[model samples]
Target: MPTLLDIEAEARGCVRCPLSEGRTQVVFGVGNPNADLMFVGEAPGQQEDLKGEPFVGRAGKLLDQLVMEEMGLTRDSFYVGNVLKCRPPGNRDPKPEEIESCRPYLEKQIELIDPNVIVTLGNFATKLLLNTTQGITKVRGQTYPYGKATLVPTFHPSAALQGGGGDVISKMRADLVRAKKVLATC
Candidate 1:
């Protein structure tokens, strides 16, 4: 089996879709490859694309704070990545075709990392992993079992930035607590 680094190297040179043509860099993932907990987000934002890393933007800052203060975990303890390595043009939602093209790479990352608990941030990540079209409001904070992993759907940190308010933050915090508890058992 190819190691994560090998997969990342391949991803870096990927030209499978139009996204690769315009991207500054492919945001493969970051943090511990052997992490027991993994966070899957929708896709790379401008900052992530520029930095060639996932979740280093404003929302990432909030996420980092939550992981550090709320869960008592740091970035080093978890793997953070996106469903699509390349940024969608104008930061729009990724097209289904784009996702279809890139899904296997994300799947391979999951296989390699083999995280015990997977946190799906926002609607896109949650929908893709769960194979459902359910809204985040309906599914957030719920846990679903996927093979050997426990998957949790939660609000995207960006949702909070989009006027989701204190209620959303509270729910996310509760979900983080659940994730931390699951981590302890894993």
Candidate 2:
């Protein structure tokens, strides 16, 4: 089997979709490769594109704070990545073709990392991983089997930042707590 670094090396040079054209770099993933927890987000944003790291912006700060508060864990304790390694121009939502092109990379990451819990942040990641048409609001607050891991869906931190209000933040917090509960049982 290919190691995580082997897959990342290939992703860095990928031109599978139009996203590769405008990206500054591939934000493949970060944190412990052998972690029991993993966070899967949508796609890279401007900051993530520039920094070559996932979740390194205002939204990331909120994620760190909440995970620390709710699960008592930090970024080092888990791996975080986006479904699309490359950022879409102007931060637009990734197109269907873009997602399809990147699916193999994300799947390989999941297989190699082999985390016990997979936390999907936002609608795109949740929908794709669950193979469902439902949005995050409908599928969250619950866990399902994903390979050998438990899949937990939650709102993107960006949604909370985008004026989702205290209610969204509260629900996100609850989702994190729910993930923690699953982790404990694992």
TM-score of candidate 1 on Cα atoms, chains taken together: 0.97
Off by more than 4 A, model 1: none
TM-score for candidate 2, please give it: 0.99
Q: Local distance difference test, per candidate?
A: 0.92, 0.95
Task: List the candidates' TM-scores in order.
Answer: 0.97, 0.99
Model 2, poorest ten-residue lDDT window? Answer: 15-24
The true-versus-predicted C-alpha distance at residue 127 of model 1, in Å, is: 0.5
Candidate 2 stretches with Cα past 4 Å from truth are none
Q: After superposition, how far is residue 185 of candidate 2 from its true place, in Å?
A: 1.0
Global CA lDDT computed for model 1: 0.92
Writing each residue's lDDT as its tens digit, candidate 2 over 1-186 gives 899999999999998887788888999999999999999999998999999999999999999999999999999999999999998888899899999999999999999999999999999999999999999999999999999999999999999999997888999999999999999998
Tell me the tens digit of each residue's lDDT in model 1 across 1-186: 899999999999899889999999899999999999999999999999999889999999999988887789999989999999999989999999889888989999999999999999998899999999998889987799967999988999999988997888888899999898888898
RMSD, candidate 1, Å: 0.8
